[model samples]
Target: MNFRRLLAATAASVIATTGLVACSSDSADTKDTAAAAAGETITVGTTDASKKAWAAFEEEAKKAGFDIKVTNFGDYNTPNQALEAGELDTNNFQHLKFLAEYNNGNGTDLVPIVATEIVPLALFWKDHDSIDGIEGEEIAVPNDSVNLGRAINVLSQAGLLTLKEQGLITPTQLDIDEAKSKVKITPIDAAQTPAAYGEGKPAIINNSFLDRAGIDPTTSVFQDDPASEEAEPYINAFVVRAEDADNEQLHKLAQVWHTDAVQKAVAEDSKGTSVSVERTPEELQAILERLEGQLKK
Candidate 1:
């Protein structure tokens, strides 16, 4: 099946689990009481607990009348594993594509309960200030599966490269339409992309490393559009075990990231790079399902 059809079919199958319910005030009140009575201290796992926005998020959750303990992991692989092992109640660090790959590879059923935001992948060159200046040259990309595909998409969208005419989801080096492309890609470790940029090679750098590299985010020659429909797979979200998909408290806590204070802090933390997006749980789950299908193929 095509991508949209795949998404529709997958979304339809799980609507009951992920969809929003319109309840009367009385029922909503009952749910709140029940949620309070549970008195569970939610433990949320993340890769970046030091971000000021997370502190703001915690405060907002307190205002909403629940407590959450945020735990930080040093690497990308641990958070989901912790969530799957019941060491964490939820996690908010990964996008749907990453979650899909993890689920497919690990045989886990983690699902996104609420969307956070997409941090656009950008191409930066120390010596060049414009995309046109870097034509017919090599651009470095993250070698990892999750970011390599996104880097290719960013280069393609920036008009520096071309991709094969196919239903390419998470494409690789082989998917490049080399004969029609202007630039070549060099896949490297994500952490080293900044060093590659320092050597004057154009590199698509992940947002996480920008600050440490002292690279100005706004200096990127080109970046993928986070608000675009093609970016659905890149939408970061609060993820939980499939069984907790209906946990009202977790869902509410995830939504609290959108409050004014949290949003402001998040933007500042990202150096104005993080674009806050509001997507329904159903939408996030559908994207995750579609991405998983692509991985299975």
Candidate 2:
């Protein structure tokens, strides 16, 4: 469930469906708003298409004297980059593993301020219904560094392929042991996985794209258990700069997502795909540190 290995260049359309905003200008890349502005508008970046589900939370924040702006994005790459550049006040798209990978690779100190939803990355097939039916087919996997290894792990668990190094958290396409695998592996952008599925072709699709493509990710051919110990690293979170961890409005923004109303919205709206998580800062920080260490190596 640790998708810190490869994160592919998701298509621009993901944002198109999710509703994107004007690109954050370089002029306002870094924020100097260190002081808490009473009732100030707070913009939180995200890739979730159904962010309107949080309208209640936004309203609650407004009543409590803060404006909440949910900024939707397309690619997984841009949110953290934008957050690190100070374009967004915070972001809630990626899991802890993805954030740790971003921090390690990019030298950004974005920290998970609060827990959000934890979805699955399961093997999805369009033309074929089952994994066994596509034994001779070529499967598409992510080429991104953070998700590639995890994608490989999912395929390996399906008994279709073998990695050169087994049990790696961040392996790439080069790690696949072709001699021992039955299916052909094709690497492509993570965004393309859902669209790439076709007759005799398989793709290990992430839930972000699965939801966008209208596929019920919870019913994937195979997927990780959100409550399983193996999946602890994949819990999604609202991330902010280390310096802004104590910002009251940011804390309130994080608090809104954990409410029962928002939780119900995520479940009912996402069709039970987005699993809510509640982990203490100490717990998540420890996990992040461990993941960051693994990524650094």
Candidate 3:
């Protein structure tokens, strides 16, 4: 079978059989025993950059009656692939746009269960103390497609450069009119942004990577909007197989992540690097649809 058809078949199979659960006892003692017996140990895949956030998630999951095991992946692409292959039960490292792009491009059926945090891109410099002082230097940005475009958008938002009329969706270096800035623009891997900043060039680092690299957002020279309408599409979420959307356990897991305690912990631990946002599933669906449309264009 062709790859797209194969993915559709796999997604259908996963959706069809994920709902079956064995009946067990309901008494308090038996319930404890049964819950323990049913205490499924499911693996969740996420980027190493999200370790602190996921640690908060793990604590919250324990309170919500789940024994979730989190496995850290070094990069963004592997987690969903792990989920699709049954190596992981779920993942929570990506925003709606990233997930939609992955599914469309690879023919996967991964789906989101809940919104989690907003990891905004921040512009930082080694020599400069503020955005106004960043002129006449080289700026390092993520060389990858998703982040390279995002870096340009963040730079444009800061009035550091001007983009073509096509807007920020998929901007490139050519889209930038370099004559406007005395600085040179260079693209580097997202992971290397912090080191690049330390070496005297300004870099646009994704929030999670910045957190992992121990850079405080409060000290960043310039930051992307955390609550802007433009950033709504980049809100991170808990993702599962399309078939697992209705699973009671996963629904409960989503509740744990959205609680007051989890939100507070994320805000504190992320040190403003990640912001928690609450939204109805219907609202999130609409936002995801809009982001997906932008990515496709």
Best prediction by TM-score: 1
| lDDT for each residue of candidate 3 in 154-243, tens digit (9 for 90 to 100) | 888888877656455668888888877456679988889899977877888876577678777777788779687767767888887765
Task: List candidate 3 segments past 4 Å from native.
Answer: 1-38, 49-52, 127-129, 179-184, 207-214
- Write the candidate numbers in order of decreasing TM-score: 1, 3, 2
Residue pairs that clash (backbone atoms under 3 angstroms), model 1: none
Query: What TM-score goes with each of the models?
Result: 0.86, 0.72, 0.76
Candidate 2 vs candidate 3, TM-score winner: 3
* lDDT of prediction 2: 0.69
What is the Cα-based lDDT of residue 259 in candidate 1? 94
> Model 1: per-residue lDDT, tens digit, 1-297?
221122223231332344333444555555445555444577889998998999999998888887678999999989999888778878889888889889999998898988888898888988677887677899999999878988888888888778885446678989898999999999999999999999988899998899999999999988889887668888999998775576576788889988999999998998999898888888888888898997898
How many clashes does each candidate structure show, in the order listed? 0, 14, 1
lDDT by residue for model 2 (1-297), tens: 101100011111111221112222331122213223443456778886456556756766666666667777888989988787767778888888888878887887788778886776687776445666677778888888667777777777777878887656776778888888888878899988877864435788876577677776655677666776557678988887665554444666687777667777777766787778888766888888888887778
Alpha-carbon RMSD, each predicted model? 7.3, 11.3, 6.8
How far out, in Å, is residue 231 in model 1? 1.6
The candidate with the higher lDDT, 1 or 2, is: 1
On lDDT, the candidate that comes out on top is 1
Residue 266 shift from truth in candidate 1, angstroms:
0.8
